[model samples]
Target: MPQTDLSPISAAPGAAVLHDVLIIGGGLVGASLAIALDRLGLEVGLVEATAPGALPAVFDERNLSFAEATVNALTALGVMQKLRAPTGAIERIHVSRAGDFGRSVLEAAKYGRSEFGRIVVARDFGEALEARLAELARLRRYRPMRFLGLADGGSDTRAVRVADVDGERVLHTRLLVAADGTRSGVREALGIGVDEHDYAQTLFVTRLRSERAPDGTAYERFGADGPTALLPRGDRSFGLVHGVARAEADAVAALDEAAFLARVQTAFGWRVGRFLGCGPRSAYALTRVLAQALTAPRAVLVGNAAQTIHPIGAQGFNLGLRDALTLAELIENARRETNGAGFDCGDTAVLAQYAARRREDRGRTVAFSDGLARFTANELPLLRPLRSLGLFAADRLPSAQAYLVGAAMGYRGDVPALCRGGTQPGALA
Candidate 1:
């Protein structure tokens, strides 16, 4: 992928930069929004706390599961074509609960698709997004910048104060977007609170070398401890996200490679063969963070800022990408209605429309992830039989299987223009 050093700029303190949209936290989602808006004739500015050659810790060694729809959206945005590294396709998913007699399998071929989705390492995806963002003609990139707070910009404009390497300046815009993660500053500054849930579990993740090359299959094994997922990655290895009791996480991390591999093998069984070796591991306490509202006065949240769910089903980023594309479409269509003259980028009516359309999709996604995570963790003996029966029915019944496959492939919920492969108004002319 092509890499560009952020065009150097030194805006003086208190000097104003006018824009139609100002996006805070220029990670993948923020950058994607900037790219979308810039193409739609909006002057955009991205404020990032990290410097150019380095990114926030969330973009560290991690694998991101991209739904088929997200891949289509990336392709439409011309970002997928710029990737230097290839992705691993998830052609099939095998799911089962530990100590259960039944298991379920979802195959992409049954749905007339070659793959359910693809997996890309966090670093690779970020590189592609950053490269694409650099190519934006109407985007002003600001790095090593800290958002001070929202300032009173009077009517007709939203003002954000930010400090960069040079000095502090106020960014004026008609619309403000927060793509920042869980503890979003923009969300907090706007006084938008979140309803939080702790799963009481922690996830230990790393890349693993297997005795045999992965055959385009991903495994989700639920156990007494928690769910363990192995996503196929390149180099004949699998990306492991092993969930364990929060209290036991440190001990697991302290295990020697031999012992660590043995524990995982014992929990997951020897389906895909033994895990030979693994790279360095990291752990995070699992939690679900959801903002009370999706929009504020002249401001709104996207990506994790809007909702953060457990990673059990890999719905986090995929849903966020949908948020980005939906907002873009709403803006594109609204602009056309006004003949490019009287469109208010952050009008209450426009924000309300975006929020109203998002309710069902966001609600269902979070509910599904939370429900699955909790259900798999349930260890009651009586419920085990029922859960097993459900799994078996889902596997054998075509209708049940189709519903499961639809959710897994992200064909459920609202479909966006980018995912449909239709020409977008924001596509470069």
Candidate 2:
């Protein structure tokens, strides 16, 4: 596809400048959306509050499980090939209670796939994506920009006001995509309300050099305290997500390397053997935030702007990626049908169609994540047997296991053409 050149709008007052899409926030979700839209030959502008190259690189930690579907999307976008190292293929995943003998194991063999998915470090993933973004000629990147508000009462186009460290400016576009993080200005400006539920827990994430090689096996262990995860990374290290009460998060964060390693060893048991060493630790609050509505007149929200789910299943980023791809597909279809004219990509019809397409998958994921968090955290003795039975059943039923795996991998309900490794019939050249 040929790149769209977007010259800067003249500074003259009342000058009309336009883009096919204006994306707020340039994190992974926003950036990915920019690339995807550009691939469809749409003129896109990305505004980011942070400066270029500002993403954090803590250690060999913070691994993400990219569903096969997600991998396919990234591969089609030409980002996956630039990964620093080969991904750790997750052939299997095991979920169980710390003291319970019953467990649910999901394997790729039964699904007729080489692997359920793959795990990659956050830093490497970010690097590969950024590199791909650099090569895209159609994407316009505006850094250090803060979204102010949106112009109301427009049917075909919307104006977005943003400010950088230097000054404020206005941008006009047919479609405005809010890919900003949890606290999104576009979502707020659109009068969109979010239903938020706090888990009242904090997640401490870090990297550990384990005595045993992970061998592409991911483990999730639920205890009375909270859920702890061991996600495989390159080498012999593992990414750790240790959930604890909010009160204990600070103390845990303050622990020295040895003390922290001791605590992790006790909490996670010997499944991965002793933690030989630990890296820097970070903490984040666990909460679920779902936007009551994803779209308004000439705008729509994607990524964290639309919803923020708990990290129990590492679904936050994966879901955000899916949102980007799905929106791209919808816009590409509309653009092709209109021959790149007359159709407002952000019109109510388009926005509504996008929302309707996303409703079921988003609703189910939020419910599943919220329910799983609540179930694992619940100390009620009466629910223990039910939880055990559910796990045992999930283990025994191949169909059930495949369903869960497919959902986790972003393959449920009307997957996008690119995700299915197929091209849309009328996709832009």
Candidate 3:
């Protein structure tokens, strides 16, 4: 990988420049796709609405728990190696209910692995992505550019209108990718409908320094109100995500540092000891968004654009990363099949294959995240015994533990080659 400058964004309306793929959204997934396709020798274009050298708004102080598969894929793409800060390894996980009689503990060593995944700050991760994107030699990046709308479709390509420094420009591409956020403009333009659900809960995220430093163990505690999570951070501070009812969000946010720390310590026992100090906190309303269709004519959706699930299981980014890698692998495979004779990246058959391959993964991840959230949030007394029984089973039964560990490690159906340990992008058949 090598550095390059931004290409000219203004082109003649009639003489639309054709591309193998035009990805609209230079965030995590889009940038990762550009890097993957760059390896396959394709004319790729990346559209970033944000100003040049500025990180996307999606990157913030929030912390992300990366699954093993996501780690492998990012490492293969050379993005993880450019991380500016150290990451915290998740070697163990503990799950419990505040007043439950039983709990479950998953250890990576039990499954013959050193660690299941790592914890990274969203802001730092975005910096690493920026570093990797700057190193691409052939990526035609259009910064401070806006995706106006979609033009008429062609037999084998799609026309897109975008505006930049000069003016409006028409660009043609064999494939169009919508890696935008939950409220995606491209997906809407493609006539795709989104199914949404409001959880009525607000999650507050921040960093807390406890008496004892994090030792690679992630704790998730469920209560009647919501769930509290303590994730290990690289700087010996714990990343805390405390979920409260939407009605109480304001009061919770307004709490003083000492009061907030006391409430968190009460909800999440004294497992790690007293919380001495904290940092600035942010709040987000939890919502689930799922696209009705993954593909349309000469176009496809990826990342948060395709589906946004609850963050209870920490499955959002990991699932989206898998989507990006799988699509890239399919495109590379199609190109290899044609022996570089130039095949349409947006071929109907190829898009159909991508949808089919992603079916099992998307469904399972959505269900896992949504189900866990709803199950833990139910305050019915009748379900308490059942929840305890389930926890007990997960703790004592090897089969149950295996299933939980597998899902946590992102070993679902039809995994991409790049997600496999030690496998590179071009390893696809």
Candidate 4:
């Protein structure tokens, strides 16, 4: 890693010296944003707290369900090709409650599609993203860079102070993007408030070798205790997510491999067959966090910075990816017009537009995930029957099925040019 020290310049005096965008964080969403912006020929600088190549492929058994639409976005960005490994295509999803008669089965065949999405290991996905990032010549990466604080933004320039492992430095840019995790330093320095609610639960994740093949089917079983999901993997292994109360998380994590496997098998049932072997288990606190606002004067928040939802439906990362793509589209369009002349990248007008573009999608996703969490955790007899009926309707209704397919595919509103597989036109002068 390299170190650079630069004096902080007054926002007004240094208005002309800033890059087009300076993103503070280099996780998946941040890196993706840099790639998208760089493709549009924008000058982008990504500051990361970790050193380059310091990213690890933690063997913690976790995977992501990349919807067809997400796959298309990554494929267009030249990321999918790098992930040249066998993926588990989810042709059908079965949702049911233990001791309940009604269940919902959503099949891709109903929509004339072979699969709703494909599952890829977290490490493989991260590797592919890293490979594409390395090939992007236009994106400047500053690793081992720690964000110090935010300097005030002027009419043209936004000043961000950062430091490396050695000393302090300052970076000037027109737009500031915060893609750090839920506890984002950029968001905090910008005075962005987050509404966080602890779900009083934790998620236990692990990989299991099963006696029977998953057959490309994913299952979500809701019990009085919590929701458990079984997602297929490439090597005939299954990724399991078991939600437990907050008080029980430590106990679950402390369980030996055999004890943990037994609890998992009992919770998930024998639909996929006997759980043969188990890997180490990891636990994460489950909470719902949302930014009071997605964007401030000249700054915007992406990924977990904007919203951190419960992992009930695996919506957190997918939502972040959408945020990255949406902002890129907006910024790319702004760069093309004469009106964009002297436009402050961190201007409230632009930030507001970005926020508006994202509100509906974010709101809907939050509602969906929160509602599912509530429903699965409820034990009311009347609510149980109602939930069963709703599931039956969702399984039987063609229109409902189509809606689910579209939602899962990530095509909610007006599609972005990049998502439509078209080149983003240059921004206005």
Worst lDDT 10-window in candidate 1: 2-11
Candidate 4 per-residue lDDT, tens place, 1-429, comes to 222222223223334446788988877788788778766666678887766666633312477877776777778788878986667888888888876668888888877889877888777777787888888666767777789897765667778887765566578887889998888888899898989888888888777788897788888898776789988777778778888888888888888888888898888898987888877777778888899988876789999889989877667777788899888888766655536566456656668888889888898889888888888788888887788887788789888777766777667665466665666344343
Ranking by lDDT: 3, 1, 2, 4
In TM-score terms, candidate 4 sits at 0.91
Report the candidate with higher lDDT, 1 versus 4: 1
Taking all chains together, each candidate's TM-score versus the true structure is: 0.96, 0.93, 0.96, 0.91
Candidate achieving the largest lDDT: 3
lDDT of 1 at 377: 90
Q: List lDDT for all candidates, in order.
A: 0.83, 0.79, 0.88, 0.77
Which pairs clash inside model 4?
298-346, 335-427, 335-428, 336-427, 336-428, 337-428
Candidate 1 residues lying further than 4 Å off, grouped into runs, are 1-9, 427-429
In model 3, which regions exceed 4 Å deviation? 1-5, 11-15, 427-429
In terms of TM-score, which candidate is stronger, 1 or 3? Answer: 3
Of 2 and 3, the candidate ahead on TM-score is 3
Pick the TM-score winner.
3
Better of 2 and 3 by lDDT: 3
For model 3, what is the alpha-carbon lDDT of residue 403?
A: 87
Can you tell me which runs of candidate 2 are displaced by over 4 Å?
1-7, 10-15, 56-61, 424-429
Give the per-residue lDDT digits (tens) of candidate 1, residues 117-138. 8988888888888777767676
The Cα RMSD in angstroms, rounded to one decimal, for candidate 1 relative to the true structure is: 2.1
